[model samples]
Target: MASNPPAPEAPYAPVQPPTDTFGYGGYRTDEGPWEEWNPTAESIRPVRGKHRVAKQRGGGFARSSTVLGVGVIAAVSAGGMASANTGKAPVSISMPDLPGVGSLISDDKPAPEAASALASFGSEAAVAVDADADADQSVADAGEALRSRIMAQAESQKTQVEVKAAAAAAKAKADAVVKAEKEAEAKAAAAKKKAAEEAAAKVEAARLAELAKQYTLPTSSYTITSTFGQAGSLWSSGYHTGLDFAAPTGTLIKAVHSGTVTEAGWAGAYGYRTILTLDDGTELWFCHQSSISVSVGQKVATGDVIGRVGATGNVTGAHLHLEVHANGNAEGIDPAAWLRSKGLNP
Candidate 1:
């Protein structure tokens, strides 16, 4: 772009001052004449690019340029006066004092004193802000620490509870195992004892069966008229002392076991009697016989005919009275029980 040349300086020309309405000149006092001036484009032109503001340093309003620094100080002074009028504390601002600038703002205080007061006020504000920041940081740190401590304590308590629960569960399981083992042992012992008892009973039954083949009844086809220990007035003793087998007269009587005939003779109440003594000294007595077949001291076998059934010598009927005396005792035992001991039913 082409630049235009600067306009020449206008000539100094003078004009008469104007009157209000009647062409009368305005009154002039002091020792000077009234002069007239007319504004032109060149006289009222705005200056450009002549004064440049220096860049500010350290974010402060103070500047190296005297013209710019004076404007900033004037604005701060106006703002302070406005705050004071509004009943609020005046804001303090720090700035470098420009030479001859303080005379334009405040004539009462020197520029250095005003600059010092502003710097002191700014320092105090900075200190207060730093203190507040430090206090907030401390509060934040304390809160974080407390939260961490609370979390740790809660975690520890939870861990302890979990451990205790696990321990209790383990103990219950162990106790259950012990109880089950004890119950199993008891069942096994009971089964063993039952098996042993059954075996013993089987052995006893087999022994009794073998003894059945060795013994026999004394007589056949005969009815038992009376048993041992029968209470009656027909006998001399208070109770019947023998087992009576009733049959027709002359019915043969057999020996109960292998024994020697100890005696065969007529007694007071026994018509014909025979006594058999075994090797073990167990005596068998046969009374009320019609005839005696075995002689005295005769070794007779089991099932041999020893006497005959007869009703004689205080007998109620034809019957054979049999008695058993162990070890040759005079008192006889129950003949039926003695026969059962030898594995005979009667």
Candidate 2:
């Protein structure tokens, strides 16, 4: 038989529970070297696969999901930043469809190389953003300049229009003034012409009145029976050669002007007639007289009674036939005209 195992020790040792070095129970009277050491990542080693981190119930899975979600959010935010840097609209990022939830939480740590690449990308994106901003500012400045130019041109045009309007108004005002002045001048000239015409008329009237003062009619109450040059068969001449003044049978006839009696006789056609010669060599013949009052060769004043009118030879009524011989012409002139020449209207 195999040697029997050494005799078992006697059961005198007391049984003891497991000792706890981690101090979970509470205080420790003595401090260890581990307490003096400040643990750094370089000094500490990560737990191997054999060791596992302990967690509360249901906490480990939730923490892993949260970390995964944060990583996805960071990636999407980086993409948005890239779009903004490129001056493009931001695009929505969707999570890739993974076959299992484990894929989302598989790796929590990022690689060193990827982190360096993200840093470089961020620097380039910043440069892109600055360039975009500069371009945008340039465009805005150009637009502002264009707007300013348009405003300036509009202002210039408005000023020109105003100037033209002002000039036109001034010209119209000046024209109105000129027109008023011309109208006033025309009215003044017309008034002056009328006044001159009236003055001339007054002077002519005065002259005619003075001329009329020197003239008178032959007899006061006599009526004109016939004018000179009247066509009649009663006279020896075909036309009457004297003016006939009808009166009563015993009416006095007067000398028309200051003259000398040239003849007082009964001619064939004139019975008991008289003739007078004026200082101007004009002869006056008074026929159809009833009787003669002045003798021949007698000097007589104007208006002296020379004869009385009666129905004498070749006369149909009591009247005086007066004839005027201008400058001793045989053909007798019209007595009416001769009287008018001496300012007497027959």
Candidate 3:
């Protein structure tokens, strides 16, 4: 605590830690925090602890930097190797659920469960489409059958129309035939009526002509002395064959009727007789003629000078013997009755 003593002196005066060079030849200083001790090159000197600081700043700092660089290089190499091997980091996606996720990515990716379900639906759609196509075909077949039946009906109708037309034509032909037959029958009836009328007219005209052929005696002084069929001894053939007209001589026997004298000749058994043939097949005899003015085959008009009458043969007295015969037959009908039927009486 209190005893102080004098210390031993260094041999060379312990070099004063080099005097701090001052002035122009010493340290440099300023108002900054660190000051320079030396100002000139002459006063420059080394510091005492410089070596130690240099050592620490040199090798020790270099060693530590190298270590750090090596560590960085290793880290880069590891990163490059990991990139080359794996290509990229694994990615994760967010989705709703497995139940509905396939419906969202239908354009691109397909999940396993989703792909199986799609295949099943495709097969079912194909079957449904096939069934629809078959149904359509059946419908088409039914329509075709109906159309064929309609066409058949049309053909049958056309056939029926043709039959009706044919029947109408046949009926028209029959009607024409019947009409023609009726016309022909009517014409025949008309012709029959006309012919009957003509025939009746002709017969009536002939009757009138016959009536004109007969004439009556002017005087009712004559009688029939002999008949055509009177059988007696006076007749040459045991029959009174000729008609007789007994009248007084010079009885005006003007004319029997208006007729030409076809014959004016003598007849045997009628001496001095004159015969007059009329236009008809009738012979008129005027027997016992006093004279005859007409000759045979002479055409004489009625009331002409044909002859005069006289009893010249087989007469009881001078009486006119008149006889009438038809077609030169000696046996003749009653002249009076025949003349009455012709509208004349004698």
TM per model?
0.49, 0.43, 0.35
Question: Which candidate, 1 or 2, has the higher TM-score?
Answer: 1
Clashes of each: 0, 0, 8
Alpha-carbon runs more than 4 Å astray in model 3: 1-220, 303-305
Go through the candidates in order and give each one's C-alpha lDDT: 0.74, 0.71, 0.58
Off by over 4 Å in 1: 1-198, 232-235
How far residue 226's Cα lies from its native spot in candidate 3, in Å, is 2.8
TM-score, cand. 3: 0.35
Model 2: per-residue Cα lDDT over 252-333, one tens digit each: 8888887899999888778778989988899999887888899989998877898888888888878888999988889999
Model 2 per-residue lDDT at 211: 53
| Candidate 3 lDDT over residue span 224-288, tens digit each | 67666778776567876555666666655555655555555566666666667777877776676
